[model samples]
Target: MGDFNQSVVLEAIRRSGEGSSRIELAEATGLSAQTVTNITRRLLDDGLIREAGRTINGPGKPRVTLRLVPDSRFAVGVHLDPAVMTFVLLDLSGAVVRRTSAHTPDMEPRRIVEAMAATIDALITGSGVDRTSIAGVGIAAPGPLDAEKGTVIDPPKLRGWNRVPLQAVLAEATGFPVVLEKDTTAAAVGELWMRRASADDSFVFVYLGTGIGAALVREGEAVRGSTRNIGEVGHIIVDPDGPSCTCGSRGCVEVVCTPQAIVAQAAHAGVFPEDQGMSDVDAVEARLTELCDRAADGDALADGVLRQAAAHMSVLTAALTNMLDVDRVVFGGPFWSRLADVYLREIPDRLERASATRAVRSLPVDGTVVGDDVGAVGAGCVVLDSVLSPRASALLLGH
Candidate 1:
């Protein structure tokens, strides 16, 4: 059977969870019953799926149901942030069987790649899963990188990473196919797949990390731009005359609304301890956490800074929703876990008041239920997506 038909049948069964009869599979995948049978037979032969008893719903004959064999395959997902490196080994069902994290080494490409290779080995070995069953590794990194070539192109604040061929290096070192994706887009994919969202649901995912970025998911597919570098929302101009950005622009969202920017604003407002140093990524993360904690504890200065940051972020969020005509926005990442409540409370009002379609619909802002490991989980989903998810592109090829 062709791979496209196989993927369609497999995805339909997988999405159905416990099981789906051949008839149900055909309906779900828009494939004929004979095609579904042929594909399922091939999948069964490959141990990718198995019959899970039979459904007898007052029928003349019992209908066989099919389910995915979760242990038949696995994949590794790596999230490389400026501050931390997270690794997760996921089974066919997208469950994280094993997970680990370590502080990201200094941004030397060779050192980071070597460390990642070791980490990948450790995760696979420690999981006790069949090594050969592992599909590949999916990596989510800060972007502006070339996704086509799988190279890391000069992400902000990460030194020594200029057009580094990360995918090829990791593939060579780990002996597994490697797929690279932008962190935000990977997270958005993770959300959609993990939630089993229908094709009609579309939303904008707002990612808050060392920096801010976004991903647009329309009809269950992430909009990968011509260069696959679409969601660099950080550069959206929020304030025309506020401050000069690194990109030689005035008051971009990235320059004014990132965690670093919030931390800087707090420091300037004399919120940090006199002896505290905010010179590096770790320090900035620590300070951001401290500020969030203080704000949660009702510290006036900390609350003011966070609210101010949320206000700036609202400008960007509102603009994105208005421009895209999307009604849903999701916030996630390490920093978002701390600031979720404040953002959920603040962003919706700004969105409704400023939205072009306020009279027709209300935009809802929600926090990620995937927790802090969203990027890592999403990274793993990239590998699963490549192997199992059905795509419309398959139709063009006559699959």
Candidate 2:
């Protein structure tokens, strides 16, 4: 019961960004003034909220303004990938307060889990945030994940990671609530939470990382199909006679546009070598950064590689826009950061030139402000939203 009230107070503080006066809380929540006051007092005591100046809307009268103490309760987000592991500490306002990252331990499942737990502990202690105030830990891993069981069911890239109960393991280690979601779904959560757009009914979040995939958000929820793998857009066949994908598809977006594919092409072109630490994605990303810097310095090879990659991505994006009737398209992930300028330069032009609806409506395409940590931050939001709204949170959390 007390937990429910605290959640309400925290949510009120989040909604009233500048802080809410006691009166505003009562008005907004329809809770009695006394109830609002009590919740506020408890939140203050819990160090989850604080008074910030005063509301002066009452002419000469002033009411003490209360707002979320951004650092009061922290949530740790973990994004696990084949190439990297990203950890972000988010404050109450969904703002990243601190971050730590390490290379993904591409070992056996047990070894990776052990390493992950140690890394997570180090991050928590390094951040100097209260352990108790950590609402929960959220993990974003490659699909297909069993969110209901908080496990990674089977991920193609992760060898021996089948049916791994990540949430339970993490919870046991940290003694904190832990939640798991497919990386794409986590991206969707981040997109929706940060955008704060309640009007749009259909949109797609395309994540361009080492690979290309998407999360389909329709009617305010991620499109989780019968098996919860609704938006595996990376495998959508764009060219029947093109190259083959690891997913057994030919001429798929992922086969042609992933960072791996781009670097591979550059390697084949002798721009970089197969053994110059560019075989894996993280190494390739480092090389790409150098290449991007070189491209800025007028390196013909690097410039051409990015242009070719962007051209393929533009094709993929055009196909998505034509098929989804998507009101908005969000591009995110690490590769997107490097590819954003190129995509913005070339993709929009391609979309305008090739899109079927180019004559009807504006096709809005933009990069996610939340870059590499998009998945992790969204994972935290999954827990944060749950804590803030009891009924909704309970439904998702299975509480």
Candidate 3:
């Protein structure tokens, strides 16, 4: 309970941004003033928080404002995308202190893990931060992970990664505790942290990346599933007659709403000169970007393909929103940027038309505020969460 109280106070201070007085922290966190004083003193002594200027309240003594020391502790966030690996060093206050990325080597998974450790070492060394200040490392990888065993179970697109114990392996390699999270869920966590001040904190995050996934945020916390693998939306059917999937289903999100699928749609539409499109990650990325650019440039064929993609995506988004009953939807992932212009213009109306709650309330659609590095940033935020988020901190430290 002491740890939980401390977390509450710290989170309050972080959310306060400018800082919070002992009275403010007590009131905000529902802790007694004396308890707030003790917690703040300990936090100050631990260098996790510091006292700023004091404020006097109407004939009372000056109240010292407590603010989080952003650099008091740090965490490394790694986004293990198939095409590239991104690394970010985030301070306790959830600020990115340093960031770097490397194209994922063609080496096997074990060698790639070695490269990841090396890059992490270089990242920390380059930042000039004390090694002891790092709390842990957080990885945002493709989903269907064995969270309890810390294994990646046959993630699509990544070869030779079947039931790999990523958490244990990375921890052994880096000598820091590791937390693995689904990329989509990590992105949602990042969005929640960034939008902590928003009144309505629940939304469905529809992740567009090498795969299509969904994550739910309820109130202000990420709803990680029982297996901690919640957003496995790939097999969810979005188009009944669109495309057949490896799952023996017709028009699953995996086949209809993914970038590769959209690129395939373009290829079939002759949006490109070739009858068949590229199959590699880099080429698929380049083709998707070109398709979006052509759509932006008023090429009717490209525009038609994107609009069709948007329509298919809306089917998926509406299913999530309707089932979750969330009031808003957020779109993001590695491939989100290229399709954002068309998706933003197309999904809202389509979603509204299909929304079950349309008669009761309007659902809003928007992109993640975390931008291109959301996966990395969110992965970092997950590590910081273990230190600052009240519930997560409690779980990490135990009762």
Best by lDDT: 3
TM-score of each predicted structure versus truth: 0.96, 0.85, 0.96
Residue-level lDDT of model 1, residues 8-89, one tens digit each, is 8888887888889998888887889899888899899999999889888785789998999999999999999989999999
Candidate 2 segments whose C-alpha is farther than 4 A from its true place: 1-12, 22-47, 58-61, 195-202, 218-227, 246-248, 273-279, 389-399
lDDT of 3: 0.89
Model 2 weakest 10-residue run by lDDT: 390-399
- Counting clashing residue pairs in each candidate, in order, gives 0, 0, 0
Candidate 1: list runs displaced more than 4 Å.
Answer: 273-277, 397-399
Q: Is candidate 1 or candidate 2 better by TM-score?
A: 1
Please rank every candidate by lDDT, starting with the best.
Answer: 3, 1, 2
Of candidate 3, the 10-residue stretch with the lowest lDDT total is: 390-399
Candidate 3 residue-wise lDDT, 351-398, digit = tens: 999999999999989998988888998999998988888884355753
Per-candidate RMSD, Å: 1.9, 3.6, 1.9
Give candidate 3's TM-score: 0.96
